[model samples]
Target: MSADVAIIGAGYTGLSTARYLAASGVEPVVIEASRIGWGASGRNGGVVSGKFRIGFAEMARRWDLETARRMHDLGIEAIDHVGETIEELGIKGADYRPTGSLRCAHNQVALDALRAEADWLTGTLGDQAISMLGPEEMKAETGSRDFPGGMLNRHGGVIHPLNYVLGMARALAGQGIRIYCETPVTRLGRTADGIELHTDRGVVRARQVVIATNGYSDLTPATDAVRRRLIPFRSAMIATELLDRPMLEHDRSYTETRRMMRWFRKAGGRLVYGGRGAFGKADSAAAFAALEKAMRRQFPQLAGVAVTHRWSGLVGMTMDSLPHLSRLDDRVTFSLGYNGTGVALASMIGRHAARMVLGQKTDAGLLTSEALRPVPFYEIREPAVRLVAGYYQFLDAIGR
Candidate 1:
């Protein structure tokens, strides 16, 4: 098989790349190991978090203030881009909701920090969409008294993740883009003309290749270096039975400020809660019980609520806690490491990668410009991740 461009992984990023490439009159072949949206793209909490893993102050401390501000603004734009694409394309069955999101603080100290961050975002960054919510306001908005305070971003919201990606896949299929499910690329090598991707069925030769396999990079040998730079972590979620009303007052999605943060939202009359999972395990009965215990602590009213579904997915975590996009060679481009904020950001980055493949300049700014260094002693990343997870839990316990 031969094509102008080839995309591996049919998750949000890969499908988004294919969509834009097709729009540019380039029919790209997309290969997926499983079905479309079978990874984190479909298994996430469905929150369109218009923010990054690192906060604005941390971003400023690491980089400059101006660069930090621009990156934050770019995240907001990425959220808008997703909403625009869904609306413009008339993508149906996505359950797209612009209900916004709330970042809750676990304690008074965290609340004070949240207030300061809100001021910085509104005053310095001129982000009028974000506002601080005190305890009363937060309780009124979220229907939970566990949070001391929170910040609300009017631009952030939620969607049916599986439906969203599947909708994009259907639309791309209508445009004559070849989508081969259950077709995994085992190796990626450079050919004299361009690049060659060897799969179980056959080899696909394309002038340019986009590696969209974010958390599942271990599936492709071409991304070994990239894989070492990313620490794959499992995140698990449980969906409760349909409730009487929305779990949140305004149906707003929410996340706490802890290292092992809890993200939850009301969707389809069910309360969906999720967080980081145990090291080296995808889904387990113990993990689900722990998550349910956390949920009960947060919302005691649902102590006996029935959990209808439990699921888990891998998330690619970068060393610096930021997403990385780069062009490895003239014929190879890739984007990954979303740090759990991939629903919207991945789509935007995928488009940028597509532009890069077409030899067009993209405005990725510091994201693509920053070098992605591999984790130290990455060969033992599994045990290292376990240690890191324990450290985070310890910090959370002491409230440091």
Candidate 2:
């Protein structure tokens, strides 16, 4: 069908952009290679927050101070956006709870870093919602005596990510947005009128095109800028069998450590943990075993917990850990590279991309800045990433 805008990839970014575009009287068509949210957007720990390792200060330096704050706030606001949409549309299955998020440090040094980060968010960044937790408090809240200290952000929350995406797609489809599943666009040809997207079923033409395929981005023709700037990394996650009643009562999402950070939470009454998988073997048996062993070591009470589900997905990792929203060409725009933090950022970036495409001005920041240039030597990024992943896997094996 003909449209004003055609979006490839019906994951969070594509869905959000389609909704906004449709609301603005633009009946955008979203084409998904598989089912909606079939990628990382569907499979995630569902932590919706802006507490990224890429702190606000660095963001301000890269983009602008005001823009950085606004971008950070946007990430925080995406959680509310999801909740509001669920309520407005009366979606039943997408469970959203504002339970907040905690970041614990396994060691004393890392605990100090957590305290410092919390302090920076409060003192410098003016985000007072962050509170430092002592060792005793961490033990009480997380039911993990191994944690030395931590920080909690009340603005953060969790949800069933897949259910949310599916609900979003349904909401958009009801609003005249044409969503075609299992229709991957193999060719994107620019014409005088607009862009042509060639899919397996047929071809579509549109004035504007958006590439929302974050990690799985190679399917369509990408501008050199995008190809050079973004690197895809695979993250693995495993969910344990429904924990016994005692463990269930103390379940909450959390993360720890310096390099290989662990992000996990209780979903469907089972403990789900995520982290860097074994590079090329991301989510392979070795990776799953490592995740389970690490989890068991963290909470020996859960040593009896057997893994029931294991999966992995590629994430677009930008050097700055921020995503890009810009015009690669005259009509082609994109918002990619969530840096393993897509739950909230994808929705927020999708909104930014929509605004940019719709010709609305946005606060320029690291998350939405022209200064987000391509990384140096980016052509070799994929190979370098693979090498790094292999090295990390080897080190992880030796307990380094």
Candidate 3:
């Protein structure tokens, strides 16, 4: 098989790349090791967070205030693009909610920090996208006194995750872009014409390759460079049969300012609560048990509620907690490292990648500029995530 471009992984990134490339009259084929949306794209909490873990103040200190403001604009651009896609395609059953995002602070110290960050965002950057809600307002919005305050993004919201990716695949199919599931690229070789992707079925020779594998990127000889940097940690979720509390009518997604990154939201008649899983990839009963305990601790009324379902998915965490794009060689360009906020970001990164393939100008800015350094001692760190995860939990406990 031969094509102009080949994309690995059928998640949101790969599908979006194919979508954009096809729209530009470029021939692109998508090949996935598993079915489409079999990874994080299908299994995540479905929040279009449009957020970065790093606050704007810290970002300004690291780089410059101008760069920090640009990052904010980039996030909104990503989610807006996703919103436009859903509307243009009229994706059925996506259950998209434009009700916005509420980032609750677990403790007073965190609340103080959030308030300061909100001040900088509004004052220094002159940004009006987010606002700080005090304890009283947070209590009314979240129906919980555990939160001291919250940072509200009035644009970010939630969706039916699986349906969004599947909808994109359907639209791509309509455009004659081929998606082949269970078609893993075992090895890649640079040929005279382009890169050759070898699979059990056949060799696919393409002028260019896009590695959109993200968390699912494996430690194989073909893609070990990525695995060393991609911290493939698992995050799990439990859905309650009944949302016993009064969920905020305005907020569609609720995430807490914790190192563990716990989140929950109203989904129809139920509530889907999720957080970091055990450090290992293979989930344990202890992970779900911990989730239940944490959920009850946050809302004691949920102790009697029945957990209807439980599941886990991998998130591609980077050292800097930012998405990255770079070239593997002259023929292979790749993007990854979303740090668990990939829902909207991944698709936007893919569009930038497609534009790169087309040799067109793209506004990726720092996204395409910051090529991530490979994680140090990744071979050792991969097997021993407990030490790392434990430290994060400890930081949360201390409110650092």
Q: Which candidate tops lDDT?
A: 1
Q: Residue 156 lDDT in model 3?
A: 71
Q: What lDDT score goes with residue 219 in model 2?
A: 54
In candidate 2, how many Å is residue 159 off?
0.4
Models ranked on lDDT: 1, 3, 2
Candidate 1's TM-score reads 0.97
Cα miss at 381, model 1 (Å)?
1.0
Worst 10-residue lDDT window for candidate 3 reads 219-228
Model 2 lDDT vs. the true structure?
0.77
**Clash list (residue pairs), candidate 1:** none
Q: What is the C-alpha lDDT of each candidate?
A: 0.86, 0.77, 0.84
TM-scores for all candidates: the values are 0.97, 0.92, 0.96
Query: Which regions in candidate 3 have their CA more than 4 angstroms from the true location?
Result: none
Measured by TM-score, how close is model 3 to the native structure?
0.96
Q: Candidate 3: RMSD over Cα atoms?
A: 1.6
Ranking by TM-score: 1, 3, 2
Error of 2 at 384 (Å): 1.9
The candidate, 1 or 2, that scores higher on TM-score is: 1
lDDT of 3 by residue, 1-400 (tens): 8889999999999998888888788899999988999989999888996677677678789988877878888888888988888988777888888788888999888888888877888889887877988889987887778998898878778989999999989988887899999888899998788899888899998999998899889834566767777788888999988765666656479989897789888787787889988666588899999998888788776767898899998989888777888777788888888888889988767778898887777767567767777888877865667787788899999888
| Per-residue C-alpha lDDT of model 1 across residues 1-400, encoded as one tens digit per residue | 8999999899999988998898888879999999999988988888987688888877888888988888887888898888887886678988888888888998888889889899988888888998888889988877778888898889878899998988888888887889999988888888789889898899999999998998988876866767888888999999999896545768778889898898899888899999977678456788889999899888888866799999899999999888888887788888998988899998777678888889998877577878777889988889988887889989988887
